[model samples]
Target: MTELVRLTGVSKRYETTGPPALDEVSVEVGTGAAVAVMGPSGSGKSTLLNLVGGLDRPTSGTVEVAGEDLGRLSEKRLAVFRRTHVGIVFQFFHLLDDLTVRDNVLLPAQLAGVPPRTARARATELMDALGLGEKANAYPARLSGGQRQRVAIARALVNRPALLLADEPTGAVDARTGAQVTEILRELNRDGQTLLLVTHDRAMADRCAGRVVELSDGRVVASTPAGVSS
Candidate 1:
């Protein structure tokens, strides 16, 4: 498989005197693969996701995503890179309550300068694929937690990103809903979406990802195939 992401000896420190959030961590994610990073709080899983998604930079070492060195890109270029190549889904579904589901899904593509017709068509296609076709006219406040999350996923994929980074995707939902979301992610990966998930939910990790990387005290302790105790 082709490598889509690479972090080599990467370390991040929020303060000059404190311990780093990540400690010389090295990881690689291949194209069309789903990899989960799992750990307790403060284990640097979210930090790793942020760096890979171009939302933040590391204090030391390199982060390369889709053949571009994140450390070398200017802020403007990085922003553009993120819009074009990376999509991120947060734990809390950040849907705009005022916007309808379809509008929320279309926002990213609009911001990226997609033609109105094209964006609408893509949004509709994704919403239908995610089983949100009937809810497209509904506002987020009227949707359940799982529906809102599905909308977020649709929004994240509107621009056809090369990498999708999900941070605790099922954190806010109940077991049944999380299971639905897990299946959605699993299907997405099966359809060739490269995913990097930062989650502590072992079940979701095992169900959605083919590989798991375990972290502790900001360092990777294990990298194993799915279903292994990571």
Candidate 2:
């Protein structure tokens, strides 16, 4: 399989007096593979996710996603790249509270210049696939946590991005809800979306297809395939 993501000696620093957030990290995520990144809090897992999605640039080294070097792209181009090529799922399910479920899901497509009619159709299709067809017109505040996350998933996938970067996707939900989200993510991966999950849940990490890299004090302490403990 082709590599969907590659990080070569990537490093990020926030302040001159403190240690780097990411310390010379290097890894690869294959196309259509589900790779999990496991580490304690503040271990640069989120930073890695941001870099992969072109949300931020590394202070040193390189971050390449889908054959594009994120560090080399200008802000405007990066915005376009993220809108069309990458999807990000946050722990907080960043849906607009006032917007209807379908509207929130269609935001990405609309921003990417998809016509309103086509975007609406795509949003409806995704909602049906995610079991949210009945709740399309409901506000996010009215949904359960799992339902909200499912809506977020539907929103993330509305554009059919090649890469999906999930940052602690199940952090705000219960075990059952977390499992449901995990199953949905796994299903998406099975259907050919490359997944890069940044999480601390051992159970979640254990279920992914690619290797898991564990970080400690801003450095990778271990890298192992699924089914093997870090």
Candidate 3:
């Protein structure tokens, strides 16, 4: 399979004196693969996601996503790259409470210059697929946790990004809600959306990922096919 994401000897350090947040980590995610990054808190999972998403640059080494070297892009270009090629779903369900679900999902497409009619059509299709059609006219605060996360997922996918990066997607929801989210992610991967997810939830990893990378103390300790013990 083609490589969709590649990180070579990447490290991030906030200060010169402290230990690096990432310690010479190397990881590659192939096209159409669902990969889970699992680690304890402070194990550098978020840093890895940020680097891949172009939200932060490595202090050393390179991060390449969808064939573009993130470290080489200027901030403006990176923003464009993110809107055009990458989509991110956060643990907190970062929906704009003031906007209706349709608007939230339409925002990325609008920012990317998708024609309003086309963006609305795409948003409607995604919402229907995610079983969120009825909630499209509702505010985020009016939806359940699971519904809100589904809205976030719909928003992330509105741009048809080459890569989807989900950070602890189930962390803030109840167990039942998390299960629903897990199934949604699994279905998305089955439909060939490349996914790189950071999570502490083992069940989610096993359910949604074809492969898993384990991190410890800022370094990769193991990598295995999903459903195998790491």
Candidate 4:
């Protein structure tokens, strides 16, 4: 498979911090693979996800997504890069409270300058895929946690990005609903969407592609096909 993302000696630090959030971390995810990233709170799991999705930049080293080095791009170029290549799903649904579900999903494609008719068609397809076809006109506040997250996923995917970055997507929902969301992600992956997910739920991580990377105190501690330490 082709490499979709790569990090080389990546490290990030906040102002006068105890230690960097990410410490010389290097990893890669190939096309169509699902990589599970597990770590304790403040272990830089979200930071890693952010960098991969071009939401944040590294303090040192490099972040390459779809072969483009993000550190080299200006803010405007990075915005275009993000829209063209990456799709991000957050732990929080991050839906627009004021927008209808269809409008929310259409935002990315709109920002990317997709034709209105084409963007609407794609948004409709995504809503249908996520079983949200009936709720297209509803505001996010009217939806349940799972439904909101599904809407967020649809928004992320509206542009058909090459990579999907999810940050604990199941964090706010009940176990059953979380499982349902996981299945939706799995189905997408099977349909050839490359996925990288940051998750605290070990069981959920295990259900993804057999590779897992565990982090602690800003460094990787273990990685395995199963949850057990190797």
Candidate 5:
């Protein structure tokens, strides 16, 4: 498979005198592949995701996605690169309360300057695939936690991003809802969407990813196949 994301000797430091958030880590995810990054709080999982998604830059080393080195892009160009290439689903569904489900899903496409008609079609198709078709006209306030997440996934996918990053995707939902979201993510991966998720949920990691990379104290301790003991 073709590589979609590559991080070589990546590290980040918020405080000049303290330990780096990510310490000389290197990782790669290929096209149509799903990998889970797992670790305890402050273990650098979110930091890694932020770097890959272009939300933050590494203090050292390189982050390359879709062949573009993120560390080399100008801030303005990085913003455009993110809008065009990366899709992120936050732990909290960041949908606009005032926007309808369809509108929320279309926001990214709109930001990417996708044609309105094309955006509508893409959003409609994603919502339908995620079983949110009927909720298109509904406001986020009217939807359940799971429905909100599905909408977020649809929104992340509106631009047909090269990679999808989910941060604790099931953290806020009930068990049943979490299971549903897991299945949704599994299906997305099966359909050839490259996925990278950061989660403390081991079951989710086993279910959605083919590989799991474990981190501790800002360093990668192990990289193992999903469902295998690390």
Candidate 6:
């Protein structure tokens, strides 16, 4: 498979003092693969995710996603690249409370310069597929946690990004809702979406990812096939 993400000897240090947030971390994720990065708090899981998503730059080494070197891009270029090539879903549903579900889903595509008609169609299709078709005119505050998250997922995917990065996607939901989200992610991956998820839930990782990379103290401790407990 083609490579979608690559990190070589990556390290991130906030200040001259203290240990690096990431230490010599190297990881590769191939196209259409779903990989989970899991660890306890302060293990650099978020740091790794941010670097891969182009939200932050590493102090040393390189980060390449979809054949573009993120570390080399200017802030404006990087922002454009992220808008065009990456999709991100956060633990909290970051939907705009004032916007309707359809509007929220169409926001990314609109910002990316997709035609209004095409964006609307894509948003409609995604909302329908995610079982949110009836909720299209509703605002986020009126939706259940699961429904909100589904909206977030739809918004993330409307632009058809090359890589999807989810950070603790199920962290804010109940067990049943979390499972529902996991299934959605699994189905998306099965349909050939490249996914990299950073999560603490082993069940979520096992259910949605093909491989799991475990981290501790900013270092990779294990890399194994999913369901093989780290």
lDDT of 3 by residue, 1-230 (tens): 99999999999998898889999999999999999999999999999999999899999999999889999999999999999988999999999989999999999999999999999999999999999999989999899999999999999999999899999999999999999999999999999999999999999999999999999988999999999985
Q: Give stretches of model 4 more than 4 Å off.
A: 227-230
What tens digits encode model 6's per-residue C-alpha lDDT throughout 100-168?
A: 999999998988899999999999999999999999999999999999999999999999998999999
Worst 10 residues of 6 by lDDT: 78-87
Per-residue lDDT of model 2, residues 124-190, tens digit only: 9899999999999999999999999999988888898999989999999999999999999888888
lDDT of 1: 0.94
- The lDDT, on a scale of 0 to 1, for candidate 6 is 0.95
Which sections of candidate 5 miss by over 4 Å? Answer: none
What TM-score against the true fold does each predicted structure earn?
0.98, 0.97, 0.99, 0.97, 0.98, 0.98
Each model's C-alpha lDDT?
0.94, 0.90, 0.95, 0.91, 0.94, 0.95
* lDDT tens readout by residue for model 4, 75-139: 99999999989899988988989999999999999999999999999999999989999999999
Task: Report clash pairs, candidate 1.
Answer: none
Worst 10 residues of 3 by lDDT: 221-230
* TM-score preference between candidates 2 and 4, better one: 2
Clashing residue pairs in candidate 2, if any?
none
TM-score of 6: 0.98
Candidate with more favorable, higher TM-score: 4 or 6: 6
Candidate 5 residue pairs in backbone clash: none
Q: Report the alpha-carbon TM-score of model 4 versus the true structure.
A: 0.97
Going through the candidates in the order shown, the clash numbers are 0, 0, 0, 0, 0, 0
